[model samples]
Target chain A: MVVLLLTILQGGMAYRQQAIHGLAVTGLSDQITWGLYIGNFTFFVGVAAAAVILIIPAYLFHRREMRRVTLLGECLAVAAVVVALLFVTVDLGQPLRIWHALPFLGKLNFPTSILAWDMVVLTFYLLINILLLWYLLYKKFCHHTLQVKHYFPLIIVAIILGLSIHTVTAFMLSGNPSRPFWHTAILAPRFIASAFAAGAALMIITFQILHRFSRFRLSKGLIREVALIMAFSQFISLFLLGSEFYTALYRHTAQHSSAVLLYWGTTGSEGLTTAIYLALSASLIGVVILMVRSWREHVPLLNLASVLIFFAIWMEKGIGLVVPGFTPTPLGEIAHYSPTTIEIQVTVGIWAVGAMIFTILARITIAIEYGHLKAIK
Target chain B: MANSRSTRRGFLKGTVAIATLTTATLASSSQSDEPTAFADSIASFLQDHYQRMSKDEIGELLARSERRAKREHGVDIKCHNTSAITGVTFGYALNLSKCKGTRRCVEACVTENNCSRNSNMENIRVLSLPEGTRDLNQSDHYYGVEQKVPEAGRWYLPVQCHQCDEPACVQACPVEATWKEADGIVVIDYDWCIGCRNCAVACPYWARHFNWSKPNLPAKEINKNTHYLGNRPRMAGVMEKCTFCIQRTRKGHLPACQEACPTGARVFGNLLDPASEIRYILENKNVFRLKEEQGTQPNFWYYTDV
Candidate 1:
């Protein structure tokens, strides 16, 4: 409770600063306009979209074990979407004028601008997950059985919308033909691959904690199943990373400057050299461990691998991806960016808010599912 | 049930107290730009998009803008909503051989545009390139003024908003706050912009700039003559760029940069007029544009007198 209050206080203070001073308070310039906030926004969008992994197995494959924990996936997505939206809002230069994007009221350039499509898809994804969670939880609370016909369609839509959200976000980044680093055909596939790796890792960790602390009983087999998904996704993510490197490094063209700056340093600017190497190492080690049967079956080792994979993806897909795209600006200026204290405060505050929301939702979910809290007879 | 009710009441009370304290703190700490009249603030807040506004509404908005200049900067300003003149597509051309690496045009543009002084926002950039190379990678953007003008074996390239017919910035704007005018100059409705900076990302030439903070326009420095889409003071958190000196060009005057060139290297005229200098340059001299492969179809051109 105290942490939640502190989060609110700090977040509000930082937001007020952003509101008064505009985006100048952040460490952004004309050279590198989008920074930490956008990075986080992109990462959380992936996380939100990854809920489809559980949805596919639980709903389509009709796996009873996966179905038991699908509620957790939807709840996590809700929190992730909320966090993503907050990042976008805080990053905007004119937060108060956000209504300008509304249809009819303000002119939203749809069909042409990928950003418009991203906004539409993200909103739909959030709403669909919320609706699914509400219906499922309410039914459980009232001791009612769900008819497959009633929700099968909604589940299928959520699954498709989840992919759409991430794909649209990837398109938003790649659509900028001027920025050669992000303007690639492989970006969307790479995003989904990395998202599943990170998302499954996070689920593994969350499931472990819940099983230990509450009446939630997740079998070891279930944990192993999630780890399997993480391993395959991580492998595909590595392959795509290699493909991007080969494409950029082979020709060594002027258009490859962003990748060159990212992997190595240029002149006085070290770029993200050290950070990317560390992420690559973590990714390799985690993938190796997950790929091994004995290591994956071990509970504590599996948990450690999950943590490492999550950190790797966070670093790789977050600042590591975003900052490099802007380093060698389109005009060949090498601009640098480092988030301000206020920016970090606001980011952490939003994460804390997300955690709070997830905890409350998870507690109620557990109570209803376990018959601890329900409608009276 | 009684125990639960009391706990709920206590929780509600705690929330209220926290909420009140937060509001109070925020109110006290924020540097509020509270308008003098409540009704004016409401009207400004609820102002419709520029395209949706009627002529009377635009008039009221211009008056309100003038009033805002008076209140904020203590300047008497005239905000004109000038429409484009028909049968004239404004175009610009620069002679590379005659151009020296003097930034006279840069300073002239800043002074004319009413750009925020604190942000160091300039509409023009003059890059010093070696005599042989056309590669922008080898160009120096921050050419020092301490050196003598036209240093040996160096050529100067002055870049600004090209005002493309198929501008990527216009397409990248999610809120349609920016578009190319009938006269071929791209303009932004600063009030309607949400400042996502997506347009800046989409612009290949780095023409667009954002207001990082409230513009610190001094009354003495403020230009009394301003167009609604050009040279008008902008609020914090909006995008602004070169409008090709729309206020002056629309009034039958040359752009400030064209007037400022010492060697008469800059030329401006209507592209549709065959007798115009810009058209003559296009027909005669070896002309080119930066990033022509991007298909932006920029109206601005660069040529050599050789």
Candidate 2:
């Protein structure tokens, strides 16, 4: 609690400094306008989208064991969407004047702007998860049986909305023809695949923590099932990544500057080559570990592989994907971007807030399940 | 006991109301010494978006803006928000062969637009590219202290806002803060912008600049002639770009860069008029737009009269 408070206080001070001095304090310049904030926004949006992996098989496929802990996925999604929204808010130059994008009271260029579509989809997805979870918890607390007929339709919609949120975000980036690195048809599918990989890996770690702390009992078989899903999704993600690298390096057009900057150094710097190599090697190692049945049964190796997969996807999707697209900007100039001290503080604060929210929500849900918390009549 | 609690609550409410009233009174009284300052503050807060404002409101806004400029910068400025003239679609043609990499246009644009001196934001980037190649990778804009101008076979290309017929920046704005005018120039409503910088990334040409800090132009050096959609002083945390010098071009004058060019390389005139210099150059010269395959269809073109 003290740590969270101190981080929040530090973030508050940084925010105040940003508000007074403007965005000049951050590493962002005119050349590379969006930085760590937007990168985190993109990553968290994918995390939110990944909630469907648990929802789909558990609810749609009628997996009884998976249904036991599906609420955990929903809770994580809600927390992630909240964090994503906060990142975008902090990224804005005029944070107070954000009402300009509000519907009706202000001008919202809907249908025409992909960003407007993103705003709609992300909000709708957040609301769907929150309401669905609330309804389920309410029924559970009241000792009433959940009527599938009543909630199934909402779940279906939530699933579609979850997919749309990440797809729309990909469209927002890919729609910019100016940036060749982001302008690709395969980007949306790649985003979904990587999202599922990271999302499943995160849920594995989360469930482990939950099991250790609470009365929530998750079976080894269930963890292995999620691990299998993670392994498959990571394979697809790695394949798509390899395809992108192949296309960029094979053709070697004038548009290859961004890709070169990502794989190799620009002039003197080794660029993000080390980061890319780490992500690739970790993912390969994770896939190899998960592929072996004997190793997957071992809890320690499973946890280690999950951690590796999580970090691999995070590095690949966060800095590896965003920074290169802007480094050798469309006009071909190298403007290096490294997150400043203020950005790092605020990012950590946001993560701490997210963790707090998830912990509280999970605790309440667990208490209700165990009948320690009663529903008032 | 209930009666006592109700009485205490009433006393607390009364105290809060009195405190609020006293604060309001003090705030109004402080501003009462200068009526114009108070009025300006109120007007600024209540100012409508440019499209929603009536003619009379615009007139009042311009007058108030002039007053604010004089009060803030001690400069008598003219801020015009001119409507586009019918039958005059503005176009530009640059003679690339004549450009000497002097960067005179860049300096002229900074001075004319009153761009931030401290941040060094300029709308124009005069690139010195190698001969017989259009590769942007080999181009350099920061050619410092050259012993001579137009150094040995390095041709110059001055890139500004292309003012596309279908601008990507306009489509990227979530709020309709930036848009294309009828005369083919893209303009931004600085006050309405949320400063997401989505438009900056959308633009193929790096034309848009964000005010990272409060623009630090000296009061004496600040350009007095401004346009609301063109070269007006913008607030920190807003997007600004080249607007084809809307203030001057609407009044049948060339853009500042065109006028400032010593080589007579830039030609600006109405695209609709066949007799205009821009149209003549378009019909006669082999002209091309930058990033032509992207299909932004920029009104600005490049040609060589060699």
Candidate 3:
């Protein structure tokens, strides 16, 4: 609670500074404009998309045990979307002018602008997840059994919307022909693969926490089942990463040099390159551990692998992806970027806000599950 | 479920209250300024988008902007939001063989455009590349202090906004804040721009720049002739780029960089004019555009009279 409050206070102060001093207060410059905020936005969009994993098992596979925790995944989606939107809001130089992108009141370049598509799709997906989760939780709280027919349609819509959110975001980045690092046919698949790996890993961690703190109990075999899904998804993620490396390095054009620099730093600095290597190594180790049935069955080892997977994806998709795209800028200038103090504060604060939302929603859901709260209807 | 309902209601109320507070604070803060300044601020805040505004509204906004400039910076500025001349799409051709890497055009651009002196923001970048090499990756804008032009087979390439017919920056803008003018110049609506800098990333030429801080130009150095879509003093946190000196070019004058070139290397003329210099160069010379494979269809061209 104290940490959350402190984060909010710090975030408010940083926001005030940004509003008064302009974007110059941040580490962003003309050469390296988008930074940590955009990176976080990209990461959270994947998290939201990964919610489909829970829905698939619960709705499609008809795994009765998975039904209880499916709402948890939807709640996670809501929080992730909130954070993603907040990152965009903070990144804007004129946050107040956001109404300029409004549908009717301001100009929204719908077909032309990929960003416009991203805005609409992300908002729609958020609304869908929120409404679906609320409807399900309400029905349960009112002592009414869920009619699968009613929710089955919503679940299908959510699954499609969830996948589209990340795919659209990938399109947003890859649409920029100028940035060779992002302009690839493989980016969308890689995004989904990594998103599933990270999202499932996060669900594992959240489930463990809820089981410990509340009356919530996971089915006997659910953790290992989810871990198996996470491990396979991690394998796919790694395969995609390898393919990207092969294409970039083998083609050996000036355009592909950004990838080379990202994976193996230039002569001057190897900080980012080393960081990416560490993340890749961590992911590889985690995947190997998960493949071993003995380790996967062990709760502590499983939790450890989950944490590593989360960290690996966060670092890989966050700084490892965004910064290198701009490092050797279009003009072939190497402008290094490190997040400033103010930027870090704002980012942490946004994460805190998301966590708070998730916590509140999860607590309420648990209360309803235990018959501690009554539905007004 | 009831708890969720209450929470949703509270969230909506909180959002409205915050919006109201912010708007009220913004209005009250501007009220502390001079009455005319307050009026100008309100007019600017409520100003319609460029395409939607009536001619009279545009004229009034421009006049008010001029007044604001005088009041704030103590400069007698001419704020002209000139409409594009029909049948006069501008084109530029640069004779690369003649460019001497003097960088005089860069200095002229900064002065004429009132660019940020403190940030050293200049529209034009005169890059010194290896002779007989077209690879822009090996170029450097900051050459050593050799103090002479055309040093040891090094050729200069001055790059600026190409003002492409199919500009990527225009398409990348989420709010249509930037667009290609009818006269082949790509311009940005400074007020309407949310400063996402997506256009900056989309521009392959490295032409666009974002104002990280308010531009710092001395009062005496401020250019009096300003165009609303061109070289007006830009606010902080917005995108700006070269507009072929829209104010000058629209009024039958050469751009500052073209005029400032020591050699007659830069050519600017109406593409629609059959006898214009730009058309003559295009017809006769082995002209090419940078990154033609990108399909940007740039109006700006380059050639060498070997």
Candidate 4:
């Protein structure tokens, strides 16, 4: 709690400096404009979208065990979305002037701007999850089981929304034809695949912690089922990564230099090469462990695999992906970007806030589920 | 959940306080002669987008900008909202043979556009590439710092905003803060810009620049003439770029770069005019644009004087 407070305080202070002095507080430059904040935003959007990995089987396939734990995934989604939004807020050079993009009051280039679309989809996804959580918690508070008819349509909408929020984000990145590294048709699928891998890994860790520390009697069978999904998604994520690497590095075209620059040192500058290798190594190890049925079912092994998978995806999406896209900038200038102390503090603070939100929401959820917190008539 | 809610609210309140404090600092620092006009600052803060505003609103905004400039730079800048002239489609064609990368155009642009000196945020970048090559990856944007112009077997390509008819920067801007004028110059409403820098990513030419710090325009070097969407003094956090010197071009004056070019290699005139030099060059010369495969339809062209 003290660490969290200190992080927030430091972030708040740094944020003030950033706001007052502008993005100069960041390591971002005219050459490589988007940096640490945007990279994290992209990763978290995937994590948020991963909620559907839980929702799909729970509602669509009618898995009884998954249904009970779907709300936990929704809570995670809510927190992830909040964190994603905060990252964007902190990245903006003029955060207070965001109202300038409001629909009626300001001019939003809606149909044309992929960014505007991303904003809409992300907000809508957040609201949908919030509404779902509220209805479920409210019904639980009133000692009433949920009526399927009331939430059936909402669930369908959320499932589609979950896919879209990340897809739109991918589009936002890929829409920039100028940034050759991000401009790929395969980006959206890659995002979804990686999101599920990371998202399910996070869920496994959270569930294990909950079962160990709290009165929430979550079944091991439920965790094993989630591990299956995580394993499958992680496999797909690795496959996509391999395919992209092969395609980008085969002929080593000029446009594909970003991939080379990311995976290996280029132009006497080793940018994110170490991080990329670390991510790939972790991902491979995690996938191998999770793919084995005997290994995945083991609680300790499952927890280890989850942590590794989560960290790998975070590094892959954050440094390995976003930074390389801008390394040899449009003008062929190799500009280096390393987040300033202010940027790192702000990022850590936002992550802490997200984790705190998830913890509180999970606690309330557990209390309501276990009948420890009941509404008085 | 309730505890988290209060914390979020507290976070917002803190941000608001910080924003107000920063604005107060800006006002105090800029308006030292006059008492701090919080109401005026607030009014400017709540100002409408350039496209949505009435003529009266624009006039008021211009006046405010002038006042801000006078206070900030200690210069009486004539800020105007100059509309594009009718039936004029501006086109530029440069002759590569006669050109030498002297960087006079770059200096002229910075001085004329009131670019940030602290960050060296100039819109134009003169790329020096080896002879007989279109490979941008091999191009050096920061070459010939101390070397003489037109070095042996080296050629210069001065790139700025191409003023595309279908500008990617305009498309990428979430708030429509930027748009192409009737005269074919792509302009940014500095006040309306959210400083997301998506436009910078979208621009193929690396045309757009973000104000990383408060633009440091020395009082003596401040350009007295300014336009709303062109060379006006920008804030600390906004997007600015080459607008083909919209203030000068729309008023029948050559761009600062064109005027400063010693080799007389730059040709700027109406593309629609059949008799104009640019149109004549377009018809006669082996004209091409950078990254033509991107289909940006840039009005700026380059040709070899064969």
Q: Which candidate wins on lDDT?
A: 4
Residue lDDT tens for model 3, A234-260: 999999999999989987789987888
Better of 1 and 4 by TM-score: 4
What's each prediction's TM-score?
0.93, 0.94, 0.94, 0.94
lDDT of 4 by residue, B5-115 (tens): 455446544654566576677777575644245634665667767786667777877888888887778889999887988889999998888779988889999999999
Could you tell me which residue pairs clash in candidate 1?
none
Q: Which candidate is the best by TM-score?
A: 4
Q: Candidate 2 has which clashing residue pairs, if any?
A: none
Where model 2 places Cα greater than 4 Å from the true spot, the runs are A268-271, B1-27, B30-48, B67-74
DockQ of each: 0.36, 0.40, 0.43, 0.46
- Model 3's number of clashes is 0
Q: TM-score of candidate 3 restricted to chain B?
A: 0.87
The full ranking of all candidates by DockQ, starting with the best, is: 4, 3, 2, 1
iRMS of each prediction = 8.1, 7.9, 5.5, 5.8
What ranking emerges by lDDT with the best candidate at the front? 4, 1, 3, 2
State the lDDT of candidate 2 residue by residue for B1-306, as single tens digits.
567545544553465456545555656857654335555654554345567566887787788777777777778899988889999898889999898877788888899888989576999888888898989878886887355778897888889999999888898999888999988889998877888899998999988999998888789998888888877777789999998889889988889999999999999889999899898899999999999887788889999976
Per model, kept true contacts as a fraction are 0.71, 0.73, 0.68, 0.79
Error of 3 at A141 (Å): 2.2
Per-residue lDDT over A103-210 for candidate 4, one digit per residue giving the tens place of the 0 to 100 score: 766677998999999898999999999999989988998999778888999999999999999999999888877888989998999999999999999998888789
